[model samples]
Target: MLDNAKYDQINPPSRLLMGPGPINADPRVLRAMASQLVGQYDPAMTGYMNEVMALYRGVFKTENPWTLLVDGTSRAGIEAVLLSVIRPGDKVLVPVFGRFGHLLCEIARRCRAEVHIIEAPWGEVFSPDQIEDAVKRVRPRVLLTVQGDTSTTMLQPLEQLGEICRRYDALFYTDATASLGGNALESDAWGLDAVSAGLQKCLGGPSGSAPVTLSARCEAVIRSRKCVEEGIRTAEHRDGDDEMIYSNYFDLGMIMDYWGPERLNHHTEATSMLFAARECARLLLEEGLDAAIERHKLHGGAMLAGIDAMGLEVFGDRRHRMNNVLGVVIPTGLDGEQVRQMMLNDFAIEIGTSFGPLKGKIWRIGTMGYNARKDCVMQTLSALEGVLNRLGFAGPRGAGLQAAWDHYQREQPS
Candidate 1:
């Protein structure tokens, strides 16, 4: 038996998000999403789509022609790249630093690639020699890794791996979902073959759009596997020479055609997500990518200092931590989840928990996107101080706030 229930108008609590991701989006981005929709192939909509391509190229620091959006979360973009490029039994080498690295390995395996993984401890990242050595040993067709793994709060250095891949004639793909905009990533300059990122992090937008870029080499590999759907095929068009892509929605070649000059229909574009992505990039470019990254740096530094002043140990290698998030080691004799709940229920604040081996061991604090501000950092630190004190975990009462204030003060022009 079914009972009909009436739902009330949408109203949600306002929370200051200080977690690993899904951070508060810029209000400007939300406004852009609210703009009225246009037809999928309407000249105006196509025009907006083209503009989005150009804007994301700037955001990714790449000149690749295949740069475009996947109409889903960050993971969708990653899958689109992997499923399109990886063939059955093709060798792929993955260097796992954290949970997202494991995700890459899992996706590649599902794509039927003969995945080989070399791992570093959770809190650390791999060295180039280590990766190069694995590449030499496996001689894989593709090398997949994550630029930043939010689970471990580690940003893997990618600058040297590209040249190494080139030496072996292997494609290099990195998931940059956790590090773009707020951190340094030069796709063209670093020689990455494919890169994917999401709007929910440093891009200051919601989670629906994933911006991806592919080098000519990577595009060529994906194009080889392209096949037109029977419904959309015309007599003039023949199926691609290679195997048909496994996933209809994730076929990059078809997606490329949709975003390309051909404008072949695939799926109705997620117009609102596109608008949000465009505005996110527009705002970053307007401020200058370097300045936006520096803003993240300033605020992220303050948060770290405040955590230190609170007598909390920061997790992982400080040298390799991402600019927008930090991992604070959970204190002994205190319930980590309880602290998180008190902060949420009392202060209207939200932070994140760890996963896998790190579960209940640390909390991930983020200063990213729209919430990367002095005030946000100060408020978060103050709330955390109060929570810790109430839990009978005493530290210098005002020390965290003072440390953050001191950092901001010193950053002032002398």
Candidate 2:
């Protein structure tokens, strides 16, 4: 009870977000969050929840009725699916191409699944043939993979993996947090049984909410688990009953019941986060999904071109790189963190560094969602060139900016 009021007040600057995630939320979404908050059980609040589900359905390009937002970050959605669908001793085949692949394997292990990994080096993606070979041998019950791994800025090919899983009667799950709104993702057409994404990345919203969709097959499995839980709860009145549910919060069965027409209470819904997420989806749908993806492609390509003109080596195969993020090699004799910090502190810009094996050797630049604009792209390149030049890296003055501008001129209608 010592003078708590003595604490200092702090404020953060409004810098441009050009990093991997938690990108600047659109102003429209911010205004939406300012709307009056209603009670959890209020009719208007429940109606908003229904609209959120419908909005994300369009965002995910799926007709699955179970599409809803998880109450945590993107990883929370990942855990929800894994903990609910993966039973003890189930085989989960994870194709490890980057850090997120390791994340999948780790989460699967926590769910008590037998995990098998087919690994590739960082900055590369696995070929469909390699995945097919692993599937043939492992015969896994579930194939857990990532659509985009931001750590290495690589997009794993899933077009054929889904078919392979279907052939083996295995479920296919993907984490699309990095690629969903910025890339081409057809959840239903791609044969994905379940997919999860966060609002912070390409969706241009805050990180507290996660959007997820599950196929009929996934829904059926969750429903079966729900029946087991219900039978156990009322076992005293019924003759045949099942055992207890493992983790309650991660139980998708109960979550589905809460989100479904039953509208039962699970946790107090994060109202502000839901408004942000719904508005994010609305912005994407209004822009047209394909058009939004094309914007990311254009901006990301321009950023890569700018970096190349600056004499920096672009990491990853160009054909496999994700359209929203780029990894560039840290020049010799230059401190990667120093440049990043200078960008943040001096230029009021934010960029990212790598993780695991690629840490300290690469810098990740993002051109995603609201930041995928010509001015944002040009400003980031200009700032980066200034930082690198000051740090003693030899590169032509204004070369990166000129190159990006030239590309933009060429792409303009004649």
Highest-scoring model, lDDT: 1
Q: How many backbone collisions does model 1 have?
A: 0
lDDT of 1 at 51: 95
The lDDT per prediction is 0.93, 0.89
The alpha-carbon deviation from the true structure for residue 133 of candidate 1, after best TM-score superposition, in angstroms, is 0.9
Candidate 1 off by > 4 Å: 1-6, 228-242
lDDT of 1 by residue, 103-155 (tens): 99999989888999999999999999999999999999999999989999999
lDDT (Cα) of model 2: 0.89
- Model 2 agreement with the true structure over 254-282: per-residue lDDT tens digits: 88888878888788888999899889999
Deviation (Å) of 10 in candidate 2: 5.4
Query: Which residue pairs of candidate 1 clash?
Result: none
- State model 1's lDDT: 0.93
Give every collision pair in model 2. Answer: none
User: Worst 10-residue stretch by lDDT in candidate 2?
Assistant: 236-245
